[model samples]
Target: MGGKTVASLRNRADLLKFDYTHLYGKGHRRPVIAAVTDERLRELVLQSRSWNHLAQGLGYAASNTKDTGWRPRVEARINALGLSTEHFQGRGFNGLAPLAHEPVFTADPTPERLRVAATGKAIAWFSERGYTVSLPVEPAVYDLIVDSPNGLDRIQVKSSAAADRGVHCSRTLYDTTRPGSASTGRYTRRPYEPGEIDYFFIVMADGGMYLLPYEVIGRSMKITVGARYEQFRV
Candidate 1:
């Protein structure tokens, strides 16, 4: 009584007055705050379809100008947590989809889409086989670098749907100053040289896969996957 003043007594009374849950014998209320752990952030990233989707999950309004810095902050946090932001960027989420169970294409996809799909399949294939796969930070001749028990192998992936009873793989890189015109504009096709890449990972329309050495495939402009290459099927 000597130590407790009027203010203290009033505060205690207020606390008791608000403690109806305890008096009613109802259980304690659930925690209002949840810790944002690295695992939770990674789960959100995986579930997010795009950057804006991720930002919204983190409590930032999509159209709010004040939230403009959220992306950089989130990227920094992801890096601090030892996570890669690649999954939050282009075509990364596509790899997370059920590519194996996807329906057959009714029409041909754009070259870029096809490339992304093929790369996703290649990544899954290597990952399932217990090999460590990584992408180049900068543009390189090879699409993937695979760390195998034998050694590191540079893999260039090529994909083609079955056409006229065969899978056609382009073995050359082309550049055109003017697209859609063969005449009056510079058009060049450069074939893959020896020692450029160790292997060619070919994905066919029917889900058939093959890994062939560059030496065996040579400088051919187009290599058709047929009965002869069946030995290389993986």
Candidate 2:
């Protein structure tokens, strides 16, 4: 392989064998390695140059280290942006940007868990009100399970700053029927049935909160472009 070809293979190897148990702790041994598309990865590679400039205002570093306390907070912020960070492992360059080692945050461990925890907190927040929530006996790994005296509420929690962008929606609205991008679609699509859940509670990463009507989220998906901050209008 030529120099560039060899380097590309090395980067791919590093991505597959990237280790993070040292920083995130033993609890993060098995992380989900999301298969991003070549286009997306290329876009990220290009954006990595500007990420440092963007991340600084967001309180993130351009590199990963044991010292940066920003990992947890950055993870939380990404969750608010509607991107699945449940699989974030850490943040650092994958060696594919303008700089030999630009900063790229790993999400296999950071973003996804925060979303689950936030959702759980939102659900528990409602359960504490003496509702009839059951914690979802089916165990769909949802954020919250709230059984109100009047009805039931299945909630997914999210946290985001004023800068993150992108929002996903589906037509069926059922967990099994959610739409996905065929170009880079690697996750299991789900159906988003509105009748199944009474409400979608979106807790903002910036301490703002909203009750998204099921109908609104189930009808369509939205992507934020050329912007930094956005709120889900339900």
Candidate 3:
């Protein structure tokens, strides 16, 4: 994305600037399907704007990368609480929303659904592990909040999935919306004004619920079967 922007379907003439797009086919006038074949070229094409662009074209704010010294502790919590991807499914968020559970929605039947299911599962799963789950919190209908047993330790919930690889992944984002701020962080809203939460989590379902760090999945994060997990402290 740095210097590789491409024109839309109608403005493909710009592609002729590169010899890479015309490896197999004789001329650049042919469609890419007939022109490109080499793996490297294919990778370039794959990494091309349209190929890696998120299924959902939403823009995202960069996550705070400063380590918060919480990884070892969080990992320990995950281990002690048995928060594996497999265990945090179906029932993880059940305690918070009880009767009103939202199933992962997707246009196609793919692993994205599993990621959605796993996210909901992580909420309920954490709650069952003694964490408190809160949902439909005021100001944001799509928001879910999780409170760790340590009392004040809280995590805001947000889920994402990409069917490209048949997997679903969800991550917790820090809410940076405080009163009177020009804008909020990835998960904060203007209504909260200067309101912000310190820590964030990213959970995905490759095989089960793996809690990832917010930074790893920040920009254009997509859910896929083989998507790797990234973790950030604080």
Q: Backbone clashes per model, in order?
A: 0, 39, 24
- Reference-based TM-score of each model: 0.47, 0.35, 0.29
Q: lDDT of model 3 at residue 123? A: 71
Please write out the lDDT profile of model 3 over residues 129-216, one tens digit for every residue.
8777676546642345666544543344443454353322233445655445445434532221123342234343333444443344
Against the true structure, candidate 2 has what lDDT? 0.46
Worst 10 residues of 1 by lDDT: 24-33
Candidate 2 TM-score, true structure as reference: 0.35
Residue 227 shift from truth in candidate 1, angstroms: 0.7
Native-to-model Cα distance after best TM-score fit, residue 218 in candidate 1, in Å: 1.3
Candidate 2 per-residue C-alpha lDDT over 1-234 given as tens digits, one digit per residue, 9 for 90 to 100: 376875686587689996422222222212211232334433433344333333332322335333444445544544454444333234553323344675687555444355455566565656677665555566452445666555656664444333653444332222334466644443453545656555566554444455565665553444232222234432
Worst 10 residues of 2 by lDDT: 24-33
Q: Which candidate's lDDT is highest?
A: 1
